[model samples]
Target: MLTIDTCSSADVDRLLGLADQFLDDWAEDAVQGGKPDEDYEQRSTEWKVIRPLLVSAPTMFKGLKEIARIRQSSSDPVAICCAALARTALDGFLIAEGT
Candidate 1:
């Protein structure tokens, strides 16, 4: 996997693992007692850092939705689109930060 400057490999792995689990649970309802696991809790907490950004740049909301769609795909076409969306989202985030 391509590495980002801001995130360590461990972070990437944890995020991907959590996402994969969520996807699986979504399809089969494997989560016991219908309760979220620790991974889900961690992912939700991580959102707190960026939730403010979302409030500032409502336009990024669509980009985030597109990112979720992109995340589910394993196709080459989707990979290309994912790269574009990543750039757009990053740019939108930077702009929102006045950077």
Candidate 2:
């Protein structure tokens, strides 16, 4: 099992920020109504492959609860969006890292 204790709050926040950027870019691409940007396609492909595994993991609930807490505590829109993406990325990391 992955050790949630290994990650500090700042680290979690940083990861959230990056994930948010990814999501924002994806949204922008969708709004364009043209071909998806290469980066967005790559990230979306990665998400599709990893998402089902994450949902099946027993630790998902704890990660989700922690993300919800983070989201609720953040007043900034960017922070809230980031926190939501961090929820998925956290699970993805555990599976990808096999930790």
Candidate 3:
């Protein structure tokens, strides 16, 4: 991961912007009912895009631990769980990719 001292201002700005957009979109999805194909595509794209960014994030370790905890608590066939575990794993991958 690149330290703050090594990262350019533009990189930080871009990361923050992407994070903000992701959060906003996620929030919007929370209110919807059935999932759309585009939602899956967007999430996949997000995973691909953010994985590398997370490597440089300041809170990567904390985020990873949280993901681990969620995964550990998950039962078999993970999909049977409330989707929380899947979300957590997705989050972890995203962070790791960033690195």
Best by TM-score: 2
Candidate 3 structure quality by residue, lDDT tens digits, 1-99: 654335555666677778668766875775475655576567657876986665455455445456556666667565346356545655665676674
- Model 1 ranges with Cα > 4 A deviation: 1-5, 30-93, 96-99
The TM-score of predicted model 2 comes to 0.32
Estimated TM-score per prediction? 0.27, 0.32, 0.29
**Ten residues in sequence with the least summed lDDT for candidate 1:** 1-10
Per-residue lDDT for 25-58 in model 2, tens only? 7779675977657777777778768655544443
Off by over 4 Å in 3: 33-99
lDDT of each: 0.58, 0.66, 0.60
lDDT of 1: 0.58
Query: Better model by lDDT, 1 or 3?
Result: 3
Candidate 3 pairs with clashing backbones? 51-97, 51-98, 52-97, 52-98, 53-98, 54-98, 55-98, 55-99
Question: What's the best-to-worst order under lDDT?
Answer: 2, 3, 1
